[model samples]
Target: MFEKLKDLKTYEAGKPIELVVREFGIEPKDIIKLASNENPYGPPPKAIEKVKNLASEMHRYPDDSFFELKEGLSSKFNISASNIIIGAGSDQILEFAVHAISPKKVLMAGITFAMYEIYSKQVGAQILKTESVTHNLEEFYEIYKEQKPEIIFLCVPNNPLGECVDAKEVFDFIEKIDENTLVVVDGAYQEFAAHKDKNKEIKPEDILKYKNVLYTGTFSKAYGLGGMRVGYGIANEYIIENLHKLRPPFNITTLSLAAAIEALKDEEFVKNSIIKNFEEMEKYVSFAKENNLKYIDSYTNFIVLYIKNSTQIAENLLKKGIIVRNMASYGFEALRITIGTPEQNDKLLNTLKGMIS
Candidate 1:
C-alpha cells in the first residue's frame, strides 16, 4: 500500500483560471485572477525587453556564481557580494537556511506564510508554532523560554494576515531568543513595505550587528519577475558561506539573472508600481466600506476580508470570472483579494457585491 506517504496537507494555491472555468462551466476569457499578490502593473518595460534579448542565451548555462546579478544587488543594497547568495527564489533560500543549521527545530508565530510550516515538516524538523495571528514580543519571549527552537521564521507584512511586527518589537524579540538560534526574516514583500510609516527597512548592513538574523528577499513580487524566479539572501558572511554549501551551482538561470540585473536599474519602475498599488488599495478600502465588508488594513498589495460563508462567496465570485483566494482552510473564514488595475478592481468589487447578496 505504498506505506501511507508522510502525512502532508496539500497546498491550496489560489485556484487557476482554467480550473475554475472547467469546474464551474464558465468562459476562460471572463476570469480575472486577483487571488495571488502579483504586480498588476506587470514587469518593468526595460526588464521585459532585456529578457527577450537574452532568450538566445538559453543554449548556454548560467554563471555558476551568478556574478553580475549578485554584484548589482550588492551595490544597490550597499552590501558586499560576499554577504549575498542568489537562489531560484527566496523560498529556496528559506530551505537552504534551515538545512545549513541543525538539529532541525523551527519556531514561528501562527498564521504566517503557510510554506514555512510546510517546509518545516518536509525536513522532518520539530515545529514550535505560536498561536496568534500577530506576534507580541512579550508572548514570543515566553514561548522562546519554553521551546527555544533552533530556527525562527518571521515574515514581514505576513501573508494571510498581512501584518508587520514593528522593527523595535522584532529587535526585542531577537534579543530574547536563544543566542544560538538563527532568525530568518522573510521579506518577500519588502519593496511594497517601503512606504509604511511604522516599519523600518531591514538593510543588509544592519545584519552585521544582528548576526543571528538572516534576511531573505525576492524580486518576484514588486519587480514583476515571478516567472523569472530570481531571489537572494543577505546575512553575515559566515552564515552565507555555510548556506552556500547547500545551494546548487547554476541554481538560477542566465535569463533570470539578466532580467534581475536590468530590473534593479529601473528604480523608477518600482516606484511607479508602488504608487499605483497604494492608489488601488485606497479604492479597495472604499469599496469594502461601501459594501460593509470588514477588512484589515494592509501594507502589502493584498487586502484580507472577513466574511461569512467565504468559500461559497469565493466560489460564486469564481463563476462570474473573478478569482479571489479562499481562506476557509486557514480557519479564518476570510478571503485575501489582491489589488489590481482600476478596471479589474472595479469588476471584482461589482461581482463580489452581487455574490454577497
Candidate 2:
C-alpha cells in the first residue's frame, strides 16, 4: 500500500509562534515573526467579521462548486469561471497540476520553491533542477530543447532568493517550449512584484493567452489568509477541467471560502499592505547597505541576507524574541527576512546590527 513512500522527504515548515514560545520561553506578543512571510497585518477586518458571522454555519460542508469564491476571482482577474480552480493553497494546485499533466519528466529552478520538487516526486516524474539560485532563461530554454520535459514549474519572484523573472521573458520561454509541456507559473508573490514595476505591469492574465501557461496565486500572503489556505489557479478551461477531475470534492471549508470572498471586496486592505511593504523593504535594503552586508534585492515581501554566520545570526535574534528563516534547506547560507511593520522592521535591524557587528 505504501511503496516508494519511504523515499519521500518531509517538508520543513517554518517554526510556529507557539513552538518558539515552547523552545525559548518567550511570550507570543513579544515575538516578531518575519519567518514564514505571512502578512504582518493580517486578513482584512471585514473578512474577520465575515468569518465571525458565519461561525454558526460550520456544520455545513463548503459549497462543492466554490461558486462564490470563483465568481469573485473571475470579476477580479477578468477571467472566466471555467478557467479557475480553487485549492487549499497554491501547494495543492501544484500537486493538481502535476497530476493533470501526468508528466513523465519535470523541470524546475534548482533554488526556487521546495514544494515543486516534493509534488513532482509524488507523481514519479524524472526531475531536472537548474544549477543557479536565480533561473537563467537562456539555460531554461536550452534545457527545454535538450530534455523536452513534460512539465515545468517556475516560481516568479522565486522563493528564498526573492528574485523575479520578467513576464516578457517568461512568455518568450513559453513560446519556445514544446506545446505538450505544461508550465506552471507560481505567482504567490505577484502582487508585491506588480507594485515594484516601473513602466509596465505584468498581470497574470497576460500569460493566460498562452495555452500552455497555468498561473497559480494565493491569498495567503497579501490578503493575510494563510491560515485559511485560500489559493486559486488560472489556466485554459481544458487544463482546469483535467485538474477538476482529480481534485477531491469540497476540498475547501465553508468558512475559508466565505473569508476569501469577503477579502476580495477589501481591495483597499491589499493596497495599503503593498504600500507598507515597499516602505519597510526600503528600510531593510538601507540597513543592509549601511552595514556593508550583501542582500538580494527583492520583488516580494521578504529579502535574503547573505550573512556569514546565518544560523548564529538567526539564533541571536531568536533569543531577543525575533524569528527569521535560516535558509539552509534551499542549500544557501542565508536568512530570508520578511518585511514587517515599521517597529518590527526596526527591531530586526537593531537586533542584527548588535549580533553581527
Candidate 3:
C-alpha cells in the first residue's frame, strides 16, 4: 500500500552535524557547517537568561493566542493585535497562507525556497514556476496575467539566489494584480536586504495599503532563535481572522513565545547580527574573487556560488568535516554557504580554497 503512494517527492533538509559525524566517522567538534544560514553568534544573552528563568514554569501551558508576543510585535510594527498572528515559525505561516488560498493554482519563482513547492504539493495545488535570474517586475507581471493564480508567492531577497524586487516595482505589480488574488511577500531574509533606504523594511502599515497583501517574517535567521521556532505574519485583520480559523490551537510553545518576546526587545542583538553578517559577506566575496569562482551578490546571510559538480564538491567537503549546501535539487550548478563568524568564515574559505585547488 505504501508503494502505491507514488505522488510524493523527497524534501532534502540540511544535513545535521551529528548525522554527518556518524556517517563520516568524524568528530562533530571538527565540522564547520555552512549549509543553513543560522546566526553564528547564537541568541542574545538577555533572551537566554530570560528563557532560563522561565524554565521553572515548564508545567504551565503557553498562551494559545500568543497574546504577549503578538502585543510586542504589534507595538513595534504599530499595528493592532488583531492584524497579527504568531506561529511556531514564519514557515508555518507560509504554510497557512498556501492552505488558505491555494486549494488549486499556486505561482512561485523557479529558484525560490523549496518549502514553497513542498507546501504547494501538500495542499494539492498546481505550482506554476517561473524563471528569474533577477526579479524583473515586467517578467512577473507577464506571468501573473497569464496564470491568474489564486495565490502568488514572492520571496523578496529570494533564497538560494538572494535577489530582491525593488519596493516601488513590487508595489506597482501589486496594484496591477486582480483584487481577488492574494499576493504574499515572504520576507524570511528581509532583515538583511540592502534597500537603499533602511525604511524599506516591511512595516505593518505597509501591509494595509493592499488588501490582498500579506507579509511574513521570522526570528530564526537574524535573531539567532531558530531552535525556538517563533515567527509571525501581518495583514488586514480579515485575512488574519481567516488564518486564525485554520491554525492549530496552541501551535507555539510557552518558552518559545517567552524567548521571542525577549529577543524582540534586544535591539542590540539584531544590530550586531547584521553588522557581523556584512563583515563576513565581504570575506566570502574576497575568497570567491581570489579563487576566480563566480558567485551572486547577496543581501541575505548566505551567498550562492556557481561551481561544477556541486554535489561532488559537497561530498568531498563533508569528508573533510566541512558542510555546505549543494544546489542540485534546485537545478543550479552552485552551492549556498551561510555567512558565519569571522573565524568560521576564514575556516570555511581556507577549506574551500584547498578543495578547489
Candidate 4:
C-alpha cells in the first residue's frame, strides 16, 4: 500500500440539509442550504419526470455506452458526440486526467479547486501552485516554462473565490505551453460565469480547438443535478478515445442518463436559473458593499467574503438553519456563500449583517 495513503485528506463536501437538521434540531423545511451551489429551483421539470419514469429500471444495469447522455451533450455543445467523455462527475474526469497524463509535475493556480492537489498527491506527482487570489498569467508563464509539468489544471470562475481568468488570456497561455502538456479547463461553474459577460464567455468549442486542451463541465450546478453526478469532458476524438480506455464501464446510472437527456432538452430552465442566479448574486454583492464587507467579485453562483472569524459566523448561521462554507480549510478565514432564492438570500443577508455589525 502507498505510505501516503494513510495521511490522504479526503475531500470535504458542503453540509447537507439532513445533516444540519440532525445536528441543530432545525426543521428540514426551515433549513436554507446555500453551501453547495446547487440550483434551488431544481432540475428541469422534464428531468424530474424522467428520473421517476426510470425508477423501476434499477433492476437493470446502466447503459455502458451512455449513448443518450453523449447525444444530449453533443447537441448542447454542438460538438461531435464522439469527442465527449462522460464520468461520474467532473471530479472523476479530473482523476482520469491526472492518471492519463502521468505528469511528473502538475501546475495550477494556488487557490483553485482543492481536488487537483489531492488527486495529484494521491498519484505521487510533484505539484507546483502559483500563489494568487486570482491566476497571475505572467507568473504561470514563468512556472510553465521552467517546470514544464505535463498537466496544467485551470478552473474557470475558480471555486472558492468565484473569480476567473479571461478566455483570451487562458487561450494565449495554452498556446505557449509545450504541445506535450495537457491543459484541462474545469468549467464546472461555466453556466453561472457565462452570465457575467456573454461576449467573453468561455466556450468549450473554442477551447477544444487546441489539440492539447480539454474542457470539463457538469449538470450539477445550473441543471440542478448534483445528486445525479453527470459531467463530461470535451476534446478532440483522439483524447476521448484514449480516455475511454481508462473509463469505468456503466459508471453513470440509468436514471442519471435519462435525466441528463431531458435536462439538456429544457434549455429554458438553465437560462432561467442563470437569470435568477445573476439577480441574487448582485444582491449579495450589494449587501456586502452596504455592510462594508470585503468580497471577491464572483462570475459564478458563489461569492467569497473575507471574514477574519469565518468559523464563528458559520456557526451562527448554522444555528439559524442557514449553512455556508468556511475557508479555514484553505488556510485563510473567509466565507463562500452560494446564491439561493430571494427569501433564502434575504435570510442570509440579515443574519450575516447582524453578526458583522
Question: What are the runs in model 2 whose C-alpha is more than 4 Å off?
Answer: 1-3, 198-201
What would the C-alpha RMSD of candidate 1 be, to one decimal place? Answer: 1.9
TM-score against truth, every candidate: 0.95, 0.97, 0.95, 0.97
Candidate 2, overall lDDT?
Answer: 0.86
Clashing pairs in 1: none
Candidate 4's displacement at residue 202, Å, is 2.1
lDDT of 2 by residue, 316-350 (tens): 88887898999876666789998999999998888
Report the candidate with higher lDDT, 3 versus 4: 4
Clashing pairs in 3: none
Query: On lDDT, who's better, 2 or 3?
Result: 2
Give the TM-score comparing model 1 with the true structure, all chains together: 0.95
Candidate 4 regions exceeding 4 Å error are none
Q: How many clashes in each structure?
A: 0, 0, 0, 0
**Which ten residues in a row are the worst by lDDT in model 3?**
194-203
Q: For each candidate in the order shown, give its overall lDDT on alpha carbons.
A: 0.81, 0.86, 0.83, 0.87
The C-alpha RMSD of each candidate to the native structure, in angstroms, is 1.9, 1.4, 1.9, 1.3
